[model samples]
Target: MRYGTLDWVPALDRPDLLAAPVTEALASWAQAAPDAVRQVLVAEIDPDQADTADMTATYDLPLEASANCVLVAGKRTGEERIAAAVVRATTRADVNSAVKKLLDVRKASFLPMDRAVADSQMEYGGITPIGLPAGYRVLLDTRTSAGPAIIGSGIRGSKILLPGEVLAELPGAEIVAGLATEIAA
Candidate 1:
C-alpha cells in the first residue's frame, strides 16, 4: 500500500517502525478489529519532516488528508482529566470550548510538551491516539470520521495512513461533531 507516494506496510508486521506501546496497541486492535486494523498502513519518513506542514509539502499531500492528534488536559474537582483530540489539519481542536466542556473543567490547555512525550511514551511530534494511556479519552472529530487520513505512527520516522472511520472504533474513542473549528487553509 502507499500514501503520498511513500511505500507502506502492515504496521503489525513492522513493529520496529512503531513505538513500543503502539506496537502493543496495534496487536490488540488487530485481534479485536481485524477488518479495520488490516487497512492501517505505515511508511517510513525522514524524522526532520515528521511535523505536518513540512511533511505535507515535501510529500505533496493534500492538507485535507492530514490529521493531528492533540493532547489536552484539565482538572475538575482536583482530579486531572486528559484527552487525545484528533482533528483534521484543516481545522483546529476546539480546546477552549468543546473540549473544556467535555472535560467539565474550567479550563483546558495543551498538555505540556515534555510531559506529553514522557507520559505517553511517544516521541514529541509523534504522539498518536493508538497507544495513549488507558485513562485518556480519545475524542475524534466528526469531520475526520470517513475519509483517508495521515496521522502519526508514534515515532518521528514514520506515519500511518488509514480510513478515518477506523479511528472511531479505537478503544475509548468518541466521535464529537463540534470538536473542531475550521481554519483558513
Candidate 2:
C-alpha cells in the first residue's frame, strides 16, 4: 500500500513495527478474520517525527489521514473505569461529555501518562486501539474508524495503515457518533 510518500508493507511481515500486544492481537485475529480484513500495512518513520504535526509535515501525509488514540479514566461508585478514544488528528476526543456519559461516570479525565503507558504497555504518544487491555472500553469516533488512514503502531518508529471498516470491527470497539469534535483552524 502506498500512503503519500511512504511505501507501506504488510504488518505481519514486520512484527518489529508493532507493540507486543498488537502483534499478539494480530496473531489471534489471523485465525478467525477473513484474509482481506487481515491486511494491515505499516511504514517506517523517524521516531522524532511521530507527533501528528511533525509526522504529517515530515512524511507528506495529510493530517486528516491520521488518527490518535487517547486514554481516559473516571470513577463511579468507587470503581475505576477506563476507555480508549480514537479520533482523527484534526479533532479532539469529547472526553468531558461523550466519554464520561458512555463510561457512566460523573466526570472524566485523561489517564495519567505514566499509568496509561504502564497499563497499555504502549509508548506514550503512540498508543493505538488495536490491542488495548480487554477490560477497557474502546471507543471509535465515527470518522477515525472509517479509515484508509494512518495511525500509531504502538511504537513511535512506525505507523499503521488500515481501513475504517477494519477498525470498526476491532475487538471491543464501540463505534460512536460525536465522540470527537473538530478543532478550530
* TM-score of every candidate relative to the true structure: 0.98, 0.96
- Model 1: which ten-residue window has the lowest total lDDT? 1-10
In the order shown, the candidates' Cα RMSDs to the true structure are 0.8, 1.1
**Candidate 2 colliding pairs:** 145-164, 147-164
Ten-residue region with minimum lDDT total, candidate 2 = 30-39
**CA lDDT for candidate 2:** 0.88
lDDT string for model 2 (48-124, tens) is 99999999999889899899999999999999999999999999999999999999999999999999999988899
Tens digit per residue, CA lDDT, model 1, 1-185: 65676888988888888999999999998888999899888988899999999989988778899899999999999999999999999999999999999999999999999999999999988889998988999999998888988889999999898889887788888999999999964
Indicate the residue-level lDDT of 127 in model 2. Answer: 92
Give the alpha-carbon lDDT of every model: 0.91, 0.88
